[model samples]
Target: MSELFDRHQAVLPKWLAIYYSDPLEITHGEGRYVWGADGRRYLDFFGGILTTMTAHALPEVTKAIAEQAGKILHTSTVYLSRPMVELAEQVAELSGIPDARVFFTPSGTEANDAALLLATAYRGSNQILAMRNSYHGRSFSAVGITGNKGWAPTSLSPLKTLYVHGGMRSRGPFAHLPDDEFIAACVADLEDVLGQTRPGVAALIAEPVQGIGGFTSPPDGLYAAFREVLDRHGILWIADEVQTGWGRTGDHFWGWQAHAENGPPDLMTFAKGIGNGMSIGGVVARAEIMNCLDSNSISTFGGSPVTMAAGLANVAYLLENDLQGNARQVGGRLIERLRSGCAGLPGVREVRGRGLMIGIELVKPGTDEADPEGAAAVLEAAREGGLLIGKGGGHNTSALRVTPPLSLTQEEADEGAEILLRALGGG
Candidate 1:
């Protein structure tokens, strides 16, 4: 074994290694490529789980951070900061919710926690409705509401929550129902839960495009229907855009906007791409929601000047360079290529998702069910072939998630697709 590996095995906590067991050691990254300790460069298709929107070590973002670092770094929320205000205003404008109030946090989990707190205060309800296969965050309350079983171990007793079915097609418990029937069943489930549970139902949280859950996109008209149900139940709608936000979807500046024709969410949480890997996350709520949390809510490092500067620069870069447009164009091309390239490949289940957030599901030759080993093999093969991708789904089953940076070039997308195709063939 290498000396570094021996040292890591000796000194690093066993629990930490168990969480991230990958053996590869990456030393540096630039653009869509990361260099390993062995000096091999690999094309990164995951884009840091969709966080590196502007690409690795983007010059403008780095410059902004450096400039801000030299000037001043931290400023408590008790006092106003220029960068914070600027970034808040820019985010509000970009979201098309001009009067939206922004609350920054250091992580997406914090942002979701904040949003949940605000929602509870606003509606005076303890009940929250979330979709199955959804992942909000790992925090206590967020995890409680998250529908994934993996998070169940974290919570002592999952809070008062109701699970609604979402995605392209509703099945399992939702098998007998048609599309409209499934939606109605979901709404009825929420209403029934609200009626049976405690009086106040705080919020109905959902991802416009479910991230960790195989990149599942909600069925058409589902958002609007869910919004109507929430309104009828006097609950707020929280859009968990932590993974889908910041122009990753290409059609809109915010993920919720893609479903605006349905109904805009009352509270939207953003992270991942907002700071372009600078550890910034936030919640944007309607002014009414902000009003409810005035006295009780607070954060020590929520909106630091340096974090705001990085976020501001990232947003500015996205706008100035029209990276969202690039995401749309390139994402379309990539999706088309994948669909065409693997049209006849056995065990290729489906290609789903929007813009740059794509998922290629792999299954047995004759069925649409998952094949986890096949998926792992594909990922490993792709990595060996100098490309890095990510796996998703509840069991980490065969779903290759392609969330490359918005700046990914057409050639790069084509190469990634080719590599993925070759990996699938090996499987």
Candidate 2:
């Protein structure tokens, strides 16, 4: 172990310093727990930023990957692979997007980038409308739609993107308006922007439930109204489901499904939970929009048989066991427990989120501004108590993002909540 650590230390890249690493190196993971180099175990609540929905080292998914890897790995999309076709068919069927065409990519960033490019190509537009505080991805085109400035440094030129504040804070471009008025203003603002930059507006992209943007859920009727406006303007609505899709939200397989009654988007992008930690992503488009693309776009490693097999197995597990229902049940219990546990803690401001994708917002004692120190204390206490967690939101503000795997037991949820409550007490 010492020799292996020495080798890794010698070759590890300096760019990785941006991430905080624990001294106890992780050696293996199973279900919702990860074991360290010292063989100590810790309960994982973040689930690899909500990627490992079915859990780690899941038997069926592993077996599928191993079996497919032994038979075949890569075949360009020019030719067909059974796993790829099957996975695409399954995704389409589950999403209720009939005969929907799927395009594979190596990451969610690529998926979002492809969606943006396709929107531009289909509409011949160069401008995109995205929500403030939303995170799409890091690639150039995806970065253009991402509202976080921290993700803007990689772009060579300023992004041709328009931004609107979602319903959360009260002082932004769309503030000082009632919910109905705010939605109408947003739609009008978008139309005004498009008129000024006429014929160049490609698409309006947003997360159904904003993830990196502090887990903010928009007010009722917002998405439906936005869909109508986009349709009127001949613009496409792209649902960036990278972080919120694949049953993370509990009630729906896709985050947008939670809003399906409102209206569906033209294109949807997925990653994270679909592959269960395997690097795979895909775009599901309405037949008409997909057919317009002329087949010029292709990826070399997009839908390799091995990754597709893993995705198929993950989806199978989700369906066969009714994991989405489990997410709802377990997530409801966890949310209620969290809200009740931290209801009156000092420096704790709000508890919000749907299903298991919960967030506990920490604020300074007297100000609405974030309480980073209080958040750090809570995180430290939770870590010391043998639970692994993560933080998110702009300004590195206080949000303890809790998204445990679907397989996490109720007992584990109780323990996790108890630890979090104790951590809040420390703050």
Best model per lDDT = 1
lDDT of 2 at 341: 79
Q: Name the runs in model 1 displaced over 4 angstroms.
A: 1-22, 155-158, 168-185, 294-297
Could you list the CA RMSD of all candidates, in the order they appear? 2.5, 2.7
Candidate lDDT (C-alpha), each: 0.80, 0.79
For model 1, how does the per-residue alpha-carbon lDDT over 1-427 read when each residue is reduced to its tens digit? 5577778889887644221235677798998888988789989888878888888888999999999999988877888789988988887776665469988999999999888888887887677888887888877888888787754556553357877776435235765677778778766766677777766678889888888877877556677877776777677888888888877887776667755765578888889898988988998888978777656555678888888898988888988998888989999899888888878888877788778999888887887677878788788888888888887775445678889889999999888888887887822
Residue 375, candidate 1: Cα error in Å is: 1.6
- Model 2 Cα shift for residue 202 (angstroms): 1.0
lDDT of 2: 0.79
Clashing pairs in 1: 125-200
lDDT of 2 by residue, 174-236 (tens): 666787888788777766776777565678888987777667766656777777767777878
Error of 2 at 55 (Å): 1.3
CA lDDT for candidate 1: 0.80
Error of 2 at 335 (Å): 0.8
